[model samples]
Target chain A: MTYCVGLLLNEGMVFLSDTRTNAGIDNISTYRKLFVFEEPGERIIVIQTAGSLSVTQTVIAKLREADEDPDASPYPSIMQAPTMLRMVEIVGQVLSDVTADISAKVDRMSQSATASMIIGGQRKGGSPRLFLVYPEGNFIEATEDTPYLQIGEHKYGKPILDRVVTPETSLEDARKAVLLSMDSTLRSNLSVGMPLDLLTVLTDTCQVQHQTRIEANDAAFQEMSHAWSKALRESFTSVR
Target chain B: MTYCVGLLLNEGMVFLSDTRTNAGIDNISTYRKLFVFEEPGERIIVIQTAGSLSVTQTVIAKLREADEDPDASPYPSIMQAPTMLRMVEIVGQVLSDVTADISAKVDRMSQSATASMIIGGQRKGGSPRLFLVYPEGNFIEATEDTPYLQIGEHKYGKPILDRVVTPETSLEDARKAVLLSMDSTLRSNLSVGMPLDLLTVLTDTCQVQHQTRIEANDAAFQEMSHAWSKALRESFTSVR
Candidate 1:
């Protein structure tokens, strides 16, 4: 299981993903899920994935391979895609193709090998956008009324987004809300673990604004965890 | 869809369930999911159901009918059961029988009907106990480490429970924690809605100490909902 959230707001887009991946309880391992495709000022696209690691990793590797090919065509790759929408299409196609190939061999084994992704970013002179790309190569964009998309272990953290997040929210505040939301998920669910990858993108700049890798023993996370526990206790006592 | 939680604490057991049921968006209705069977000081068993309303309603009606029959066997109905475990067994057996009967008919029409429940309370001199009864009649107890049981729409509210609830928690505090948890679920999911039923059973007392039916327009609930929204906004800003 995994938890990843992407918020599209006036200031820019915020992306957060947990690093834990498991085939089973005993097979749990840490693998970074955030992949950045960038040409600096030309375009900066952030892709966060959840589900079968083999499918997601292969899809991303194929995207990179396409960009590196010398004889690539007019629709070359994610890096050269003219708009955020085109970039999302390229990523969706890659995800679906990989999933179909893998699932063919595992069908008789009762194994489901599928992957999904949250793609968000901007190209020069284009408005920022966020999309939830499905395993079938289809996608949906975030609207003003629903300015965020979450994939994997989403229910545990959805309430916070429903109540406080909006398209007009500032990038800084949106980042914090998602982190605390992830924090809540991490505490309740053992399947979702730490060493998180966080990325912040400022609209129109077409560059990665801020990026951090949070480990399990990070001090800031520890402080926030302790503070939240204390607050819940105090609030519980104060009510009725 | 529904949301129900049961907590077994040192002081007592707290049970909460929301009353919203929907067959489709156009066919929404309100129904009580919490059923209490008590012989005053002797024993008190509370059952909260979630999933197909047809299955749940039928199971409870059968249990009630058995209790009303004077010729009922040595394995008495829930109202006449001597122990909390016995009451759980009786409830589970009835649930299984009704589910099998309804499922046979419902499966032919596309197979959407199923039901599960959470049963908890005390019997005379026994300790407080909580069980999560499955669709097939098998059930699991809430241990010291786990401390609570939830059925339907559970993940959306689980983060708060993982962060704050414990076996040593007082019944007063447990009640607040669950209400807030339900509040979060209500905000995020369309399937879960208002007019909640809350009951608290004190240990050794073997009877309901407090029960509340919180309607949408109830003043206290309205106030709590507003205060929680305000507190979350303030907390988000205050952090980082």
Candidate 2:
């Protein structure tokens, strides 16, 4: 239904998510899946979600509620979490709790409404980190050996990541790698579509650095798409 | 787990499959997935299987038995099938029957242990045809709009197919396209592994024109793999 990728590189972290959601072939809508929680220079946490829109939207709404809560305690919200790891844990717990509560209400129907999240960012005093949070509330951190996490329709777009992505990769290059990866998938499978959400987080900067929405007719993307088609044709022909 | 692709192209039909099978990560083993039946100038049919190996093996064994039986009726065997479409239908029916019989026993253990198949070939008087047979015995044909069929771990290798494949594609180029497609999946997914079976069927020739068993250390494959990795990096860097 969606494709989201988060890359942890030396220069910073890159997050990309597509905004297409559909219940069937004819019933499709656009929904932003990337949620940014920021306190300017203090902290900036970006969460990209996939799977059931209901579960993801609810979990995000609850997070926003916590952020706006006057009775919020020392833990407060993602904006106040001491470290990226703790912020991920809090998000995971919220997601799992919501999934369970909903599961109890709908039983079998809950299968169609389960969701997962990819949370990545930096707190003011901590190092940059990225996590893939499961619906079960467990999470895995990205390390130097595997510096990227993909959620949603990940398989079609994974080859490029395996070949070209690394922890030492620059933020700009990482962004391009993910976009091209998504481009390959978008062309192949109709389940994933765009207007895409892309965000770049500069480590330790702890603020939203760059955020852009790539629409269907975006000129830059069209050029990149054409170039890719040309390169593949040339490469395929030249390969004997 | 496996990766198999069957393409019906203008020059011919190309079929590629990986031979990796595993009960778990520790119990990996090799079993060929491509089975070819040819009456030389009369017809040639290649069947690629993915899912429960038992079901597929049984289906293949039954087809072979029918071919060898003297009293076999009007239905006969793949070798006696009137057309490529009939051959695919027979394969689909056998697959569904075998799967249903075993599934009654294994259903409790794993619901997804049922098998699926990609059957494609040519009869003496007919054009090349390809069908994707489902677990339930239903099947869909490859058309001009979508000329390739893939089974098993298909998604990891689908981007290359989406980007480069077509019905009008030459057999030479389609072969290379599929190998590169498999290469991409082999690099990223652990479940799909090596020693690939590639088969090509030329239209109206009624015999296998080319078949390759690409071993793990095969020089050409290794070169292609390395080149693909380098190309992806170059492409990523070059993308603005």
Candidate 3:
């Protein structure tokens, strides 16, 4: 239903998310799933979501309550969390709690909804970090050996990431990698559509360094997609 | 788990499948999921399977019994089937029956297993045909618009096939396409492993044109896989 990816690289962290959500084939709509929390020189936290809209929306709503009214919320705000790890824990806890609350209400009818997220950023004193948080509130961090995390329609785009991405990958290449990864996904699956949200957090900026929305018909994205197809066909022919 | 793909091309048909079968991660074994039944010069039929081992094995055994002992079979032998469509029907019927029988046995314990198959063939005087048979016995054919069908751990290998395969693609290219597709699946999923089975039936030839079992460390296969990875990484960099 969605495709979101994050890469923790030597240069910075790259995050991308597609905006399509659907209750069924005929009930598709666009919704921005990437949320950014920033304090320019203090910290930057990026959250990309996929799965149930209600679950994801509530997770964000709860996190924002902590952000906008820290004293009234039961948990510390992600923006004010002591570290990136702490911020991830709060987001995961919120997601886990929201999912449980909803599932409880719907369980009798055999309905279930849950969401997963990729949360990554940097605090002034720490190196950049990226994590993939599960619906159960557990999470795994990106390391030098595996510096990328993805949520939603992930398998279609995974081989490219697995084959090419590494800790030393430059932010520019990482952005391209995720786009190409998303490109493959878009072609194969109708459930994941565009426009896409993209943001880069330079290693120490603690805030988004560059951000843009890639529209469905964006000329540059289209050209890159066409070129990649051509290159792959050529490569396929040449491989033998 | 398995990864089996069948492509219907102008030149003929290309079928490829990985040999790995695992009851669990710790209990992996090599089992040929691709089976060929040819009455050379009369007909050539290939069945590539994915899903429950018990179900697939039973389906194949039943089909073989019909092929090898037509007098006792309730249905016409596939070897004597009037057309490629008839052959597909036989396979699908057997699969459906086997699945139902097995499921009924296990249903009491709340456990069930089913298998899906890709069957393609040519009968003398008829055109080459490819069909993806479901556990329910219903099937869909590969057409000019979508000339390839895949089963089991399919997503990782799908984008390439979507972009490169077509009715007009050469058999040579079709073979390469399926191998590379399998390569992507192999790199991304542990359940889909090496020692792949590849087979081709040239147009109008009522028998296998060529068949090979690619070993895990086969030199040429390894070289192509390496070159593909390099080409992909280069293509990613050069896309922009």
Candidate 4:
């Protein structure tokens, strides 16, 4: 289980992913689920993954391989894609291919190798975009009416996003919304744990404006979590 | 799909259930999911159900039949149960039996005829109690550490309960907690919707203290829902 959210707002885009991954309760481990693809000022793409670690890692590895390959021209690569939509298409294709390849190998054990991703960022001339890519290589883009997308352990963290997020929201508020959303999911679900990877892409910059890892003991994160809990309790009590 | 929650508090018990039932999105209808059985001052039991409507309705019908039968003593009936534990046992057994009976009839369709229930209340000489009865003839009591139980579409409504509920929580707060919890679920899930059935049992009274049906147009419920949304937004904005 994992929780990752990406927002497409007027100011830019926000992406957050938890680092915890587990094959079972006893097999828990830390793994980065956020990947950044950048060509400096040319294009910037952020991918936040959830589900089978093997599949997501393989998809990322394949994407990186394609980006580095000179003969990869015929095959779309995240770094070279002409638009955010094309970059998502490339990522989705790799993810779908990797999942299918791995699932076939593990089918005898009746285990799934399915995974999903939140892909968002902007290219120099294209508008910023956010997409939720399914395991089948299909995807849906976030629009003004619903400017946020989440994958994995989503429901617990969804109400806040549903209430607070919109296309016109500022990047700072978008960051807060995703963090608090992650906070709610972390508190409610043990499967999703800390050391969170958070990134923000300012609109048209085609560069990662802010990227940081929030550890379990990060003071700012702790303060935000505690404050949110206190505020919720106070709000609940004050509600007539 | 349904969402029903029951909390066992020191002051008493609180139960809430959404009324929407659906086989598919296009086949939705309203049906009450909360039922109360009382001999006033003797015993008061509340059953909030979720899952296959046929199984729950059959189980409730059987319990009613046994309660009205003069020769039903050989079989344990909810009205004749000796203790809260025995009452849950009776309900669990009836639920399990009806599920198996109906499931057998529908086995050819490969569709499930299973249901779960949250049963709570007090009988004379017994303490207030809450049990989550499974499809099998088994159940688990809510403890002081975790005094709440939820069934069906539960995850979306769980975070607030996890953060706010306790055996020591006041009855008023418990009602607010469950209602807000239900509100969260209603907003996040299309399967769970109004009208809602709410009931509370006061400690030692062995009778329902308050019971109400909150229709979709109910002013107070609408106010609470709007207030909660506003409060949540205010809280979110105020969080540093």
Quick one: best TM-score, which candidate? 3
lDDT of 4 by residue, B1-240 (tens): 999999988898999999999998999999999999998999998999998999999888888888888375345678888778888988888888888888898998987789999999888998999999999979999998999999999988998999899899999999999999999999989999999999999999999999999998989888998999999999998999
Candidates in order, TM-scores: namely 0.95, 0.96, 0.98, 0.96
CA lDDT, every model vs. true structure:
0.86, 0.86, 0.92, 0.90
> Model 1: clashing residue pairs?
none
Candidate 2 residue lDDT tens string, B1-240: 899999988888999999999887999999999999988998888899998888889988888987888376333688887777777788777778788889888878866558889998888878888999999999999999899999988998887887789988888889889999999888888888889999888888989998889999999989877777667666666667
Candidate 4 falls in which docking quality class? high
- Which structure among the candidates has the greatest lDDT? 3
Off by over 4 Å in 4: A70-75, B70-75
Q: What level of docking quality does candidate 2 show?
A: medium
The residue-by-residue lDDT of candidate 1 on A1-240, one tens digit each, is 999999998888999999999989999999999989887887888889999998999898888888887266323588877778888988888888889999997888989899899998888888888999999989999989999999999988888888779988888778778988898888778889999999999888889999999999999988876776666555555555
Segments in model 1 whose C-alpha atoms lie over 4 Å from true places: A70-75, B70-75
Candidate 2 regions with alpha-carbon error over 4 angstroms: A70-76, A108-111, B70-75, B108-112
Better of 1 and 3 by TM-score: 3
Error of 2 at A166 (Å): 1.1
Instruction: Give the true-contact fraction for every prediction, in order.
Output: 0.55, 0.59, 0.88, 0.82
- TM-score winner, 3 or 4: 3
* Per-model i-RMS: 2.0, 1.6, 0.7, 0.7
The deviation in Å at residue B61 for candidate 1 is 1.4
Per-residue CA lDDT of model 3 for A1-240, tens digit only, reads 899999999999999999999998999999999999888988898999999999999999989899999889997898888878888999989999999999998898898898999999889998888999999999999999989999999999999899889988888888889999999999999999999999999988888899999999899999989999999987887787
Report how far residue B6 has shifted in candidate 1, in Å.
Answer: 1.1
Error of model 2, residue A239, in angstroms? 2.3
